[model samples]
Target chain A: MVMIPPYVPEAFLTMYLPAIYAGLIVGFIGTMAIAMKREEIHILILTDLVGLAMIFIVSAVGTDLAEALILPGLVVELAETLAISEILITREMRKIEQDPRRNLSKSSSLFPQPFSLDMEIMTTAPNFIALVLIGYGIFLTGFTGGAVAGGGIVLYALSKKARGLPVLILDGIAGVSGIAWCLWIIGFLLFFVAPQYWLLSLFLAACGLLLKVASKVGLIGLLMREDIDKE
Target chain B: MEIILIIAIALMVIGAFGIIFLKKPLDKVIMFSILDAGFVLVVVAFKYLDVAMFAALVDPLSTLVFILAIVKINEIRKNKVSGELND
Candidate 1:
């Protein structure tokens, strides 16, 4: 008699089989939607949803690196969504502007509705929450948290009133942080050459991650400022 | 738990189709939001509570970003039309 050991326990498979099948079905449908849709926005949305479903399926399967990937995966997904949305919005707007009948009022456009009073109030609320996050991050993670919280504050402020010397200061901070991130990456790579530098490399890597986060948040701030100016 | 996961996945698939098929941008955005909810459900089912919380926090920010982009594009289009009229 020959015996084969199951890598995944039969009990485990039984427990999660339905979820696995469901994820597969959902992913397939999303891909099909993308193949069928001609609209840029529609394709973007379907692709994003499909990507999200794939992540869920991967996580459910208990891949060794799945837990570590969840946060970064969500962040990348949002970044991609932002990029696609920006492209689609720009293209649609250009098309509208070029049209002779683009009567601003009657044009059937995908432009977002104007913000309501409630939304304005909600936008401001992020500032305070970000302040708390900064305090907590700094308390927990030191300089790294400081960078994140600082960047977040700048982002919130810029979104609200992107102008003057403050905006210039934010830009300067972003540039500095970007440089710091690059240096840290170099330090991380050199850690293999000198084992003694491992601790320093790790610290710098954390700094680099935080700086990268700050720079991205600051970019969003600048974008918001530009968006407000366009309005 | 498995049943909940299945339901969430089904909702997500339906939402995805709705987003692709819906003609109105507002309706598509609404469907996107529903898909986001389905994502949260899936995360929760996988017992990644922390991830679910983070998704709850970040998903709305992405939606806000999209909305802002849409508003900005509209403003730019309006400005271009006005500029052409003046010219």
Candidate 2:
């Protein structure tokens, strides 16, 4: 009779232990801040910070798994950030509607002044940098690089002024791709339950990656459309 | 490396406190950015250069989104005020 010892994930856990601890501490602090401060923007930032910490903790696996994990974590954070921002904006809009005296501008200096060339240049620079990032990411590690680059493009589009059909289209594409990325993570988790689920997980991951690419391309299409419309 | 991680963690903790205690939204945003930089440093210390790069890329985007949202909200408020005054 041959005896085989049960495999333990101890080594994996140990490697990620510090990250996990940091994530937990940050997450706790974020929650506490939200509870104590009751500020939506602070909550959003803190929660996203926690999410970023979680990415580091989760990606402490093998190099390949780490790469696979990064995108899903990022997509989750991005989606939440967008959703919360929308909610905060809507809430502020409602507040202004109810009370005209509410001085939003006086309250926050973070808001950019109306459509200055410097502001436009600042916003547009990220898109070009995203392209460069995509190029370098591809040079470094093929698909993972592509994923990060695609995310950068999405960020670029999000940072730009949201206007017209083009912005709407990009938002829709980003929302779908973000959901697909989350689904990919779910599928990846399911793969650990049974070896047979590997193919299904791979399919989900591929779809997620394709959707991300589609979203990035959608941003480009939006840009071209804007140019033509301006002409 | 461990020392670097400790420093990063300490920075994050301080940022967290700042976020909770800061009076203004803009101040909180700045604190959040600092916390983000700390997270990136920790990832770099962990030798996950790719993840670190991704963090660096994403951080500015998140900040920009927040700023845009704030700007949009302010625009809506100003427009509404002007509309009311005209009425």
Candidate 3:
């Protein structure tokens, strides 16, 4: 397997890996930090192991870690895990244990957005025929719709989070994606969408964990501050 | 071939829909973990061990993060709720 493709986007590694590493570190620190620390520690250790394995996986493959022929299963599994945990946490919080009932049953009334279907169909288009054409086009004369889409997604995310520090970070990501693609737009380029799924995915997860840490560090204060400074 | 794929597809669909319908972010995260498990299971059955392993491990870890995130976000919301109440 070709390990490192030439011209790996700077931002691809920069924005992504750091975030993942952060998550691992957080898991370690978290495992140590708990009072009910015995049983919970194993889960954190599992998280750390999984994070490390991901790093190895990314180094092995140079293509879509999220959607490689080998990737979707991981994505779906990850999604499901999140679902189950989400429920457990919801119940553990000891508030409203059940989901709120909605009077209307159809997808239409629930979402209330008139155009979600349209948006879903449109988003899938990139994964459709255009993807094949674009991939071939990039292969033939070095035209990259993938990079464009990647950058576009980042930009779209920035717009979606227009008013926060996350927006700044998102914009930074989009900017990097743009710079990464600049060559693909003009000349032959090598992309390192790594194969070490465990490694990179773990890294991303780890880094994102800082957001959790920051939240925790200030949590008590935030609670107190909320009451005192209620505006 | 068809039967297995169908099962995987069904899990993915149901899990996907279930997660979205959840009001609590934490619940959403849990449903997503289930979805991830079902998908990973399918991948293994299809003989994609490497992918399945990654799914098996990483998916649940991701859930941990999501749970943490939702907890944090919920904290923020509750803080805000209390603030609103105090006001």
Candidate 4:
């Protein structure tokens, strides 16, 4: 009936969904921090583009369909990334306005604006190394990224209505997948069948919470303001 | 019957708490990374080596990009400093 995991075992993305999710969260948080904090969004943007490039290359390079869909996602991403950047900038501006020490040059704060490469290397490099993989480079690999492939311009567009909602949604989708996958593996370590559906639900829950945060943060309002400010 | 499973599961639970309750930004990053690693450890443990490896690689990439972004935003923030701050 439900066709739950252990009942069927290995339900498509359930296996690698976790990696997709982990990458998405990293990409989402990474980009959001850069967009709002950095003066020059291009540098980190390019680095992320490079990261996406790797995803694109790995997913689409030899596969014809992947190549076909490449431009679609990238084109949408260009506009979407910029839109998200603008919203982030606006929110940062709003936060800055609130600070009583607005005049104090509070250069360093939690996750200070403009990302930290030095710390990234010490802290995040190992995580990124994990993203480069493609499931034994054989059986598990697919034609497109899980998040990207989940839907297309249509779903992305639907999520866009959330106003900065799409990116958050996409990131959640990917991050949760990573978590579920980790659980699946642990299940294996204990000699058990993966609870594929349960894992999916966990990822979906995280995505839902993150979207709620974005909405509450006034991120969408920031987007609206940017569109009207026309500065 | 097993300790490894307990440790792995516990890490995930704790990582979740850290991300939610932590106030410090650096701590948030640390917690997030741990959450990420814990996630990877889980996937790989289940013989989902493919998923595990990718999970391991992505969190860092995400972290690197994140740090770079924060730095860039700070630089821009500094540039935008108003006259009042300068005085």
Q: Write the per-residue lDDT of candidate 4 for residues A1-231, one digit (tens) a residue.
A: 333334233443353455556556666766666566646556546556546744634342234555566646665665566676868777777786787486335443423232222332444333323233322222222223332222222112222223334577656655665664554445444442445556554444434433332222233334332342222
DockQ of each: 0.12, 0.14, 0.02, 0.13
Q: Could you list the CA RMSD of all candidates, in the order they appear?
A: 7.3, 8.7, 22.1, 18.5
DockQ of candidate 3 against the true complex: 0.02
Q: For model 2 chain B, where is the 10-residue window of minimal lDDT?
A: B65-74
Which structure is stronger by TM-score: 1 or 3?
1
User: Which candidate number has the best TM-score?
Assistant: 1
Q: Report per-candidate TM-score of chain A alone.
A: 0.68, 0.52, 0.23, 0.25
Docking class of 1: incorrect
Candidate with better DockQ, 1 vs 4? 4
Off by over 4 Å in 1: A1-16, A93-127, A137-155, A162-167, A228-231, B1-87
lDDT: worst 10-residue window of model 4 chain A: A149-158
Model 3 per-residue lDDT tens digits across residues A1-231: 435556565456545556566646655654455433555434544544454445544433334653343344444444455565556644544443333344322221221121111223223432343344333323322112233222223222312212223466546645554554443322221123544454544334333332222222223223322322223
lDDT of 1 by residue, B2-84 (tens): 89988899889988999999996667778888898999999998899855765665565656656755656666678668876
TM match of model 2 to true structure:
0.50
lDDT of candidate 2 at residue A76, scale 0 to 100: 69
Q: Which candidate order results from sorting by TM-score in descending order?
A: 1, 2, 4, 3
Report the lDDT of model 4 for residue A133: 33
Every candidate's lDDT: 0.67, 0.66, 0.45, 0.49
